[model samples]
Target: MKTYYDVQKFFRRFGIITYIGNREAEIELSLIELQSLKQEGVISDEDYYQCLGVLSYEKEMAIEKRSGKQ
Candidate 1:
């Protein structure tokens, strides 16, 4: 996968959907799925780390956004 969206799509192929409204929850679920895929050898370490980085950035941005809104 080239991006987080691509990684999410890859998971979707296996009926794995990590999106459930909350940004933090979604990111957590996505991370779990990414780890599972990595352990299963379905995705390379590079791809897994890349996707994790993206998700982590997104999570940080989300937290910042929410804190700013408060």
Candidate 2:
């Protein structure tokens, strides 16, 4: 997905909705779900990798923000 909203939509399409009341935790959960979909070959490589990159960046940014690094 190109954005976090798109990520949510992607998961929603598969009936997977994630929200743990924390951005980092939510992203962590999303990453796991996405990885599983990847392993199962349910998601296209392009979409999987794209979403992975965006989510990775997002998770990193969230961690950095929480640690006052950004």
Candidate 3:
């Protein structure tokens, strides 16, 4: 099993800032990051939802985003 620290490190390297918590926090953080990208015009709504699909997979897995969002 991956440790929380490992998950956090992966998120940091990919520029996705997520806090360790329950599934709700994971979903919220993913949404926040997705919204931030949309707000910055870095990703379209279609892309945001597509990415959210990947992030919302498991209950406790780490989520990552593509690197180029401003």
Identify the candidate with maximal lDDT: 2
* Local distance difference test, each candidate: 0.81, 0.92, 0.57
Better of 1 and 2 by lDDT: 2
lDDT tens per residue, model 2, 33-58: 99999999899999898989889989
In candidate 2, list every pair of residues with a backbone clash: none
Candidate 1 TM-score to native = 0.77
Candidate 1's residue-wise lDDT over 1-70, tens digit each? 4556786787787789887988788888898888888899987788778888888877787788889963
The superposed Cα distance between candidate 2 and the true structure at residue 47, in angstroms, equals 0.9
Q: Which candidate is the best by TM-score?
A: 2
lDDT of 3: 0.57
Report how far residue 38 has shifted in candidate 1, in Å.
Answer: 1.0
Q: How far off is model 3, as Cα RMSD? A: 11.4
Ranking the candidates on lDDT from highest down gives 2, 1, 3
Ranking 2 against 3 by lDDT, winner: 2
* lDDT of residue 51 for candidate 2: 88
TM-scores for every predicted model? 0.77, 0.92, 0.46
